[model samples]
Target: MFLGVDVGTGGTRAILVDRDGRVVVSEACEHQPIHSAEIGWAEQDPDDWWHAAKTAIGGVMRWARENGKAVESVGLTGQMHGCVMLDADGKVLRPALIWCDQRTQPQCDWLNETIGYERMIELTCNPALPNFTLTKLLWVREHQPEIFAKIAHVLCPKDYVRYKLTGEYAIDMQEASGTLLLDVTYRRWSTEVAAAAGIPMSWLPSLFEGPEVCGRILPEASSVTGLAAGTPVVAGAGDQGAGAVGMGILEPGSVSATIGTSGVVFAATAAPTKDAHGRLHTFCHAAPGIWHVMGVTNGAGLSFRYFRDTFTPQLGYDDLTALAAKVPAGSDGMLWVPYLFGERTPHLDPDARAAFIGVTASHTLGHFVRAVLEGVAFSLKDTFTLFEELAIPVEKIRLGGGGARGPLWRQIQADVYNHSVELLEAEEGGAFGAALLAGTGVNAWPSVQAACAATIRAAAVIPPTSAAAMQAAYPRYRRIYPALKGVFQA
Candidate 1:
């Protein structure tokens, strides 16, 4: 059996899979609410992640043992772009700056200016954003010099958990790509960028390819989580890369559109594909010897959740989606721009805020809900526009995360993209992908591709329900950002 664990934004999840890739048992433990002491800033306790991971792992292991399964290997995956700092003795220095934190714009500007914007992209294949790890580190250095002086190690969220489990400081190529401190083309840390950013290279972890053994569960971790001591832990990809692996997006021309709190449109590439404008991120793929380009929408399901929390806290997510389904397409000309947490992809503006345009007295709560949903779909289509410009082939589109769960969202995505989207038979997401990586490591399958091919199958395919309405609505949606750009800055 193979075990996979994902340290996510809200929780940690563990899954145990049998030799054939069948899921035997899965468990999740919710994290404490993320601390947001200031607007545009987000933080989480690394110790909390470790605790949640232990809970989930123990739960899954108990169930697996009851089912007569022994977990032979483990893989790890988690949210990307978090900055976790540690002291010389491996004690966490402070709360981690998670992916959604937006307090690093000044640092991003400094990095671009110091390294030269185009030159930075040339070195990292990505433009430094406020959410990237390096920018978060810079924010800490500038704002808390006392704490910065004590830093001895740095890790992304998952890698920090890996250290707790295996007593090793290590990271994978796919996760490293988001740090803005990696030479993605060569799959190693970039000394030039590190020197320019004034970050010490010695603080970085050892790099590994996904599916390679980076460490083994130590006696201490095994005691806490109930796994066998010395169980091999494979170097797993970040959540995005591992999720793509689970959805069979290993080869070029295959793509995925996933909507969690954020949305991402990912396409595998045979080689490093650069966007000279740095509008999209080109990162190393979990599958060795390949790369991927992805565009991000900072707020997708987040917009919907924000509305629910503010206006209809009593209603559940499914209830809101059902209400949204009752509304007509385009929400009767009402449009939503889901920039609630700033925007990524086409516009890397950290100050950009969300808006609801063309709301009328006649509009109902359902209309607002539908508008938010449509707005997210439209934002994701912006990536497709870039894909067309880059000539990145999109032979198949797979939907994952919140977007794949609902019939309404599936149809909405298909209409907006003007292409059919496939749903996987099992949508266990990043944890499942991590398990596949573990299976590949243990030779359960010869490669990640073979593991996915053997286990994953399309559950359904949804085609565009109405192409004309989406065609009409998208142009108006496209106009909202430009019109509000000035207002956002002010």
Candidate 2:
């Protein structure tokens, strides 16, 4: 058996997968509410993640033991771009500034100014964004100098938990790419970029390729988590990287459109494909010897979540999706801009806001729900446009996350992109991907690609519907951001 652990935003999950990649049991423990003392700022305690991981792992191990299975290897994956600083003794200095935190815009600006924007992109294959780990470090340095002075190491969210388990300072190449400090072309830390950002090179963790065994569980962690001592732990990718692996997007031309709180259009590439304009991100793939280009929509599923919390607290997601199915293709010409947490791809504007344009008294709650659903699909389609521009092949599109669970959203995605969308038979997302990595780590399979091919199979495919109407409305959806860009600033 293989164990896959994902320290997610809302919870920590542990899955036990058999040799054939069948999931035997899975368990999760929810996290406490994220601390948002100020708008555009988000934080979570590293200790909370550790606690949840322990609980989830122990629960999964108990189930595995009952089934007379022993987990031979473990793989880790989690939220990317979080900044977790530790003191000399490895104690967390403060609450981790998580991925959605937008408090580091000034720091982002400073990094670009200091490093030269083009030069920065040349080194990292990405322009510094507020969500990158380096910008969060700069925010701490500027706002809380005393705390910054005590920093001995800087690790991402999952790596911090890995530290607790193995007492090691290591991170995977895919996770390192999001720090805005790696020489992405070489798959190592960039000393030049680190110096330019005013970060000490010693503070960064050692890098490993995903599926490489980076450490072993210590006796202490083994006692708490109920795993055997000295169990090997693999260096897993960040959530996106692992998720793509789980979806079998291992080779070039294969792509995935995943919608969690955020939406990502990830395409595997033979080489690092740079968008000189810095609109799309090029990062190391979890699969060794490869890279990926991705475009993120900061508020995808988030739009629906916001609507549910604000207007339909009494209803569930299935109910909302069913309601949305009643509405037509374009919601009677009403469009929604799902930029509630600002935009990421294309515009790269942090101050952008969400809006429902062309609303009328004739429209009902169902129209609004459908509009939001279509709007998220439209946002993802923008990435496809960029992919076409970059000449990155998109021969296949696999759907994952909440968007894959509903037929309405699946059809909306297919129609909006005007392409066939596939769903996996074992659609476990990141946790399953992590398990595949674990399988590779123990040589249960020769390579990540071989493991994925042996285990993953597509369950269904949805083709485009009302393609002409979708194609027509997409141009209008593209116009919304430009139309409202000035108003958002005002």
Candidate 3:
């Protein structure tokens, strides 16, 4: 059996699976999110992610050992675009500049305008955004120049974990693509991007394919994680790349939809494609030569978290979703713009705040609940529409993430997106995707397509039912941002 370790911002999880992607055992360790109180900034200790990863992997390995399963390779997937700085001894300099940090907006705006937005996007297949690593580095250089000057190697959350295990300093193509320094067209770092961003090319780690066997666990790592010393560590991709593998979306016209801490609508393509408006991002595929265009919503599973904390403090998510079902579609003309933490795709507005639009005296908690749900799905549809514009066909979407745990929300996703939403029998989306790549890298599977065919599970599919209403409602949904766009900048 192979192992897949997923290190996310909130938690780390490890799963033991057979060649067919049937999980035999799995375990997770979740931690509290660390936040900076200076407003609109979030961070996590790299040590915390490592500890949780070890705990999860150790627990799963113990279970696998008890069950008499032999380990082969291990692959990792993680939250993307985080910036982790390592000192001379490979120790973390500070809390990671996490994917959600918004302090780099000014830097992003300056780079986007100064670097010639069209040329950058044409070369990189992505535009400057505050959440990406380049902007984070610029922010650090401007605000904490002293600390920025003393960096040894820069890494993402997954790459840092990989370094701890393998004693190798490297990142994979898929994750590196999020750094905004890599050449999306050439599949290497661009000298022009590095120079323009005022970053030295040497700060970047060596890049590899997601499935490349970078190294094995060192003795110390093995002792902590209970894996064999020579266990192969594959260069796994970012969450979206891995999730696409797990969802069988590596094929053209295939799509993956994840609504977890955030939502994403991603379509894999044989070639890199970008929206003219930069409403979507294109990244290197875990499938190597391929690329994936993605539209990200800043809030996805988070909106449900907000509602849970706001209304049903004592109720389970299932029960709360049941209450949401009591309300009809469209929430009786009520709309919600879930930009609680600003937005990514469609609107790069960092100052954008959230609101429940069109509230009236007749509205109840149920209405509010459902509107929040539909708002997220509709915003996700916004990404889907952009995918349509780019001509990256999305025939169906494989749904994953914590939000997929709720059946009602799953059904709502089906209705609002007006497409069939499918789920995997195995729960670990990103980790499982990583494992598929590992299997391919090791020649356990002839190709990614074959590995996916062996691993991806089609447990159920939710097809659209109320497409007519959603079609009528979508036009109104499209207008919410334009109306609010000016308000955010002011």
Candidate 4:
């Protein structure tokens, strides 16, 4: 059995998979809710994550023991771009500035000015964003110089948990790519960027490719987590990288459109593909010798969730989606801009806001729901537009997360993107992908690609039906953001 552990923003999850890649046991323990003392500042305790991981791992290990399954190897994954700093003794210096924290625009601007935006993109394959690890560190250096001075090591949220499991300070290349300190094209720490930012090279952890064994379970960690000591742990990926692996999106022409709290469109590439305008993110893929280009929508599923919670708390998601199904393709010309948390892909504006345009008394609640569904898909379609500009072929698009579970949303995505979308047999997400990496690390599969080929299978495909309507409505939807940009700022 291979074990995969995901230390997520809200919780820690442990999943055990058999040799054939079927999940044998799974357990999760939720962490304390993120502390947002101020708007745009999100934080979580590293100790809380370690505690949740222990509980979750212990539960899964107990189940495995009862089932007589001997865990062969382990893999780790979690949220990307979080900054977790540690002191010389490996003690947490402060609560981690999490991925959603947007308190670093000043720092982002400084970095962009210092490093040169175009040159920064050439170095890291991404623009300086507040959500990235290096920006968070800069925020700390500016505001809490004392803590910054004492920092001896830095890790992402998942890699911090990896340190608790194993006494090694290491990170996978896929996760390292998000730190803004990595020379993404070379898959190493960017000394120039670090030096310019006044960050020490020693603070960064050693980098490893996904599926490479990086450390072993420590005796102390084994006691708490119930895993045998010395068990090999592979350097897994960040959530997006692992999720893409789980979906079998390892080839150039394959793409994935996933809608969770946010939405992302990811495409694997043979080489790092940069967007000159710094609109899309280019990062290392979990699969070796490959890179990926990604675009993000800050509010995708969140739009629907916010609506249900604010207006119709009584209606479950299924009920709301069912109501949306009754409405026509374009919601009678009403469009939604899903920028509730600001735009990321095409517009990197933190001040961007959400709105429902062309609304009238003629619009019903069902129309609103359908409009929200279509709008989120339209927001994701922005990435496809960029992909086309970059000439990235999209031969297949797989659906994952909340969007893939609903028939209405599935059809809506197919129509909005004007392309066929596929569904996996079991979308176990990052944990399952981490397990595959673990198996690959132990020679259960010769390579990550072969492991995915053996395990990942597409369940069904949804073809575009109302493409003409969505295509006509999309141009109008595009106009809404530009027209309302000044309004949102005011």
For each candidate, what TM-score against the reference? 0.99, 0.99, 0.97, 0.97
Candidate 1 Cα lDDT to native: 0.92
Give the per-residue Cα lDDT of candidate 2 at 302. 87
The whole-model C-alpha lDDT of candidate 4 against the native structure comes to 0.92
Q: How many clashes in each candidate? A: 0, 0, 1, 0
Please write out the lDDT profile of model 2 over residues 252-358, one tens digit for every residue. 88999999889999999999999998899999999999999999998998899999999999999999888888888999999998988778898888888899999
TM-score of 3: 0.97
RMSD for each model, in Å, please?
0.9, 0.9, 1.5, 1.4
Candidate 4's residue-wise lDDT over 1-490, tens digit each? 9999988776889999887778888999999987989866789999999999999999999998888888899999998889999999999999999877878989999998999999999999999988899999999999999999999999998999899989899999999999999998999899999999999999999999999999999999999988999999999999889989989999999999999777889999999999999999999999899999999987888799889989999999998887888888999988899988777889987777899999998889999999999999999999999999999999999998889999999999999999999999888888999999999999999999999999988889899999999999999999987887778443
Off by over 4 Å in 3: 488-490
Q: Considering summed lDDT, which 10 consecutive residues are worst modelled in model 1?
A: 481-490
- The lDDT for every candidate, in the order shown, is 0.92, 0.93, 0.84, 0.92
> What C-alpha lDDT, on a 0 to 100 scale, does residue 13 get in candidate 2?
95
Superposition error at 16 for model 2 (Å): 0.7
Model 3 residue 3 CA deviation (Å) reads 1.1
Off by over 4 Å in 4: none
Give model 4's clash tally.
0
lDDT of 4 at 235: 97
